[model samples]
Target chain A: MEYPAFLPAGDCALSVEFGDAIHPEINARIRALREALERKPIRGVREYVPTFRSLLVLYEPCVLGFDRLVKKLQARMAGLRGVAEGKRRVYVIPVCYNGEDLDFVAAHARITREEVVRLHCAPDYLIYMLGFLPGFAYLGGLDAKLHTPRLQNPRTKIPAGAVGIGGEQTGIYPLDSPGGWRLIGRTPVRPYDASRAQPILYAAGDFIRFAPIAMVEYADLERRQAAGETIWEVREA
Target chain B: MSSGVDRTLRIQSPGMLTTAQDAGRVGWMASGFSRSGAMDLPSLRRANLLVGNDKDMAALEMTMTGVACIFGCDCVFSLTGADMCAALNGQPIPRYTALQARAGDTLACGGARVGMRGYLAVAGGFDLPAVLGSCSTGLKFGLGGFAGRKLRAGDALPLRCPEIPVSRLSERVLPVPNALDAHWRAQRPGMQLRVVLGPQAAHFTAAGVEAFLSSWYVVTPASDRMGMKLEGKKIEAVCGYDVISDGVAPGSVQVPASGQPIVMMADCQTTGGYAKIATVAGVALPLLAQAKPGDKICFAAIDVREAQRLARREAAQLRRMEIW
Candidate 1:
């Protein structure tokens, strides 16, 4: 861990990097600063992405000069310590652990299928940042015991809502994107529905808890969700 | 009274990669959405301005070529960016000037001979619904533009025109001291890009940074709207090229394990894990956009203050010359 650094992304944007590593404290610091900016507001700042360890802030160059903007950001960040995260909610994702690679992951980890499920559903994973596809929540807190390597050859198209694990990371694909992640399960809920007013359901810093569901229940939930019914609710964490 | 025309541009033959685009889809990068839009943004603005539409009005962005279209109505239009070898019904037409096209008049925009990507803007702008506050096509997610994808043959793009005034139909062209044109011409052969050393510049060794600045990288064929892969010197990074995935801004020059730089473009994914050495200045992005694959490009380190200053200067100049 180093001193909070203001690294320049470009002329119009800057990355207020908390650290080079991805730690919960580093991420929390980045999120707190973003939350403060979102509430009180900065005039020139257009948008901000609170990622794993940095807050990449895009601003209008004409409105606020680069040097001045950095000074302003520095002043705001000075008081961010112990500042609580604005709002945190855990979205309970229903996953049917019957994916093609579920057994493979269990075998690789030298664990039973039931043990794998228990480990996967145990921790409340933190949404590090959304990337690759829209509403694709990159989760943290994956149990080390279930850590499995990605497939040797990437799949052409992993189905949307396909819960997969690659290396140490576990995330659900919001779109049918080509990925190397080992598919362990499937979820019925759509994290991203463009038809909805807010295209994405959850933002970075939100928590995600995967709840195991049976195949029959999964089929029924999938059908209901397809028909625009809300299957899962956000639990205040 | 209005029996002579209709408000639509019927596509006879879609170009290589024709799609509707605006300035960009702003305010959604945090949601993992790329600012998918016209590659040569200034050209899009200029075309829109010539046709008397707002600077960011949606227009057809024909990449590496121009689209073949038939005017459904008598409308004022303007073509800008790369010399698309455009012709009006078998006759070569002029770009950067407001031109009148009659109903049923055909426009054939051929392959680019100058730069890559052409913009065709009609008066009153395109009649397309904006998704996520923009008409720019985000093809990766199948969102926005012509049903969220590139144009195909027989696609009828409607126009929002309430008849152009007869008095306003005079031949108006963009006046001299064209900065965008000058900028494009300046970056021709050498095609040097100015960059601000990065959020992850420390990830690379000092010699690596020096090598990156010195080497002349050629744009690879795999380059597209997503990113431009460059190959030249293998500038090694300290430890490894992997970073704990972070926000990647447009023009973020990322170096993966291979040690080659990949300049993220207009439609690049919002975030990446590769260690970024530098970020190309936004002011120089349009120049880079016009670069063809195999074009030799190099980088120059510029300070953030100077970078923002140049951007502001260009924007202010464009604003002044916009209505003139």
Candidate 2:
């Protein structure tokens, strides 16, 4: 399905909203639009940020006015009518089911905690967007059984590496910040680092799977991460 | 026009909060880049004019209080905005005036008494690395200006002293605006900002739109470059469309779920989903920058053409005022 072009964001940028609702197909188109822009950048184009259901393209007004830029973007969209291919990457992230909300989540879903883990690890999730905070990925395809609401009162500080679930979406808190999601486990990798060449570890179109591990192994992995050793058997799946 | 590198300004004491800033980072909002730069562009411009520098030159943005420093060599510099009481080895120096500081002499600025921010501009521009087209410091994303962070007490500042014809600020050299400047230059009374109706203006009810322009809103303590959260009548829409995320710009006023209007300033995020009621014009940005907490403000409606006219007129006046 094609999307409608939006008006200027301000004086310098424009937007193209794929759809009003959150759907997998719409998100895939959003990714496709990003790739299209990446492949053939506009003259005055500075950056293109892809969101869950839309894409924002910022440009220099001096080089290309709002009207001219919009026309250029529209032409690009029309050129890619039928061939919308979103690039995808698959990653395996190990986790331990033992958590403060593990038992509570099991009771809420009317299933065992182990069963909850089984359902969660079943499907490969796709990253729809990267927002709210830097390196915080908004992953889709969460297990229906594990779908849960946010906390009544957000915690003052959710530690970095926390793997959390909110509704049908699951995410990892790349940095220590105030959050209200239910944390099931954590990953030791630095999902975000400003000093690094690539600040964000994962981008949109990447696939992710959470692998279950024993509690002792979690502690051992933490030690390994602290010692600057690779924790996960992180290989491209 | 091309000269050699001049003496580097050695830092003696980094003040409370100081960072290198140029005009601002633009053209990267779609990439989630914030427009992080000097909060007060007018003050920076005035200071730059005093030193005969371009409007886009990099300067030090000091907040509230400032640090003590010793110039490595004699150089012409100007200080503007706020009564910080800058001094040379405890001797008082005039504000909004350029002065030559000799080497081995210490310069310091006291705390702000009226305003929250200040600008200190050297004869030439400050030597700093430009990141993604600007040297503006954005600490949140950690990009641009002094390693993308605040200047510490021990940090050193480099200088590029261009040997151009010296220009002093007097009646002859000072920027003389035209009739428009003479009329509008009278510092606007109070904090009310003139705005053009937003793209989402249609979403608001007639009463909600009326309340938005008629009522007075207070600038809260939580206000910063990211946005100004106004406290006033809670505006409710006739219907809410969980707006699809779209690009946003500086000066866009977004009315979120809480009904409070958040006026985005420089350093705001690239895009948001809130229903924006209006957008402050770029020409009026200087006035918005001077706003302080507890300041009561109102909104006045304007058309897009009027906004563009105001911006163009301001640019023309600015060009006529400066040598560049």
Candidate 3:
């Protein structure tokens, strides 16, 4: 277990970074800290935000100013390395393999389109972090054979739930946003819905599997979701 | 004071681009939420002060004016910012001075003759259910304000007055100077934005980093609450480098592929992959908030201690305003 230095992110916030390189263990610790903070919020703590390898904690300036908060955080961090044990949840996200860049990715991977789908679904990828957009989970453990670069020119607007790969990671767009990731498929599930008790269905450290579905099935899922339906199937991992 | 939803103000005209704003949203930046709220912090504070409302009280933020409202009940209110040529029931009213309007009087605010934005504050503050503990409108994320959207015609806003009127403040409060005030001379416009060099600051070439500190940047016309598109030194690493997606905050300076440094503002998304060079000190955020499009700004580097002191002093000044 390793811990990097803690530093100020900006005024009113401090970032405790774990490591420079993206590692599964480091990410797990990050998730653990996030969980612990949420489960037991500090008195003056306003926010505890997680990144790839760091946790940015924001507190109210009036109640617990930066200096005092830093001391409290330092004491808290001294013993927070071992409380990450948990039961992880695995979700099966159905994706329609009809993205605009699916063909280009298959060509780059030197495989047929069918094989790309198979490899993508074979591994149970872990959610490393939740960032960029709401419900947009950054999943690790992509198949090396499926590694691809982001598009040279990003699309002006990638449809919501468009699943794509960039470098060694893959994620779903929670909203209709401009992106540059290499697109491969799109899911029908609303990655983020404000009305739900838990707006984000997935969190860091959870595992996810992308099961490719037919275009017709995608259309049906979209319809059911629009009518306020639960689109994902959850299984304990 | 009704236990029910309280008296509601019906919109006769929704002003040009009125939106509800309070202190911004928090804790959801990693979820791609922007802390969208009032653009001018000091003025917003003043407006809240005049009404004896909490500093985080929600107010109607009018952009460039044309908003007309009707009081639902007898209430006390105050207006701040550019002379909107406001009137109460066809009688020309004064800006920056608290006014008492009876129920059914139409309060109209016209276009700006000076500044860009104006704030309207009720005695108790606008009544609205806070999303994430804020009534600030972030139209891009559809998070807060009235349904997380801009105010439109016929949108009836709820009014909730405090139990007592502002007995402390005199009825007349002078208009806040559109320019920096004499009180702020000690905090003089540093023109230079203090920054704590970011983790990605090392990614750029030494020369590039030096240029960033040395050069002057201007806030472009394209700037808004989301971010400021700056025109200055085209800063880059030895080559365009790819950085892992990371969390961002307001006042972060990011150099995208275009090589121009874009300073993220109040409405900026929480996370981004761009190589962030620096984060401007939060004490200077209010000054940045007051910047108009095409305003000239320069970056000056200061240590974190100085930034904290500056923030403390400014906050103390704000607290002192309560006495008057």
DockQ leader:
1
Clashing pairs in 2: B15-B67
Candidate 1 TM-score versus the reference: 0.96
Which is the winner by lDDT between candidate 1 and candidate 2?
A: 1
Higher-TM-score candidate among 2 and 3? 3
The digit string of per-residue lDDT tens for model 1 on B122-216 reads: 98889999999999999788889989999999999998873456247447787522344564567555677899998788999999999999989
Worst 10 residues of 1 chain A by lDDT: A79-88
Give lDDT tens digits, candidate 3, residues B1-324: 555433777787886678988778776766656777787776777787777778778888887675898887777888875567888889998777777877787898888654557888888878788876688987776777887888888888887756565454448475564343332344543355678676467779898889889887887878877888988788878657556666677778889887888988878877777888877887766666655565567777776556667667767877876665
TM-score of chain B, candidates 1 onward in order: 0.94, 0.86, 0.84
For model 3, which pairs clash?
Answer: B15-B67, B192-B300, B193-B300
Angstrom error at residue B191, model 3: 4.4
Give chain A TM for each model in order: 0.96, 0.90, 0.90
TM-score of chain A of 1: 0.96
Candidate 1 iRMSD in angstroms: 1.0
Each model's DockQ? 0.81, 0.22, 0.46
Per residue, candidate 2 scores C-alpha lDDT tens digits across A3-31 of 56564455544557777777678777777
Which CAPRI tier for candidate 3?
acceptable
Candidates ranked by TM-score, best first?
1, 3, 2
lDDT of 3 by residue, A50-159 (tens): 77777767665555666777677676666777547567788999999988888988999999999998998898888777766667787888999899988888889988
Ranking of all predicted structures according to lDDT, beginning with the best and ending with the worst: 1, 3, 2
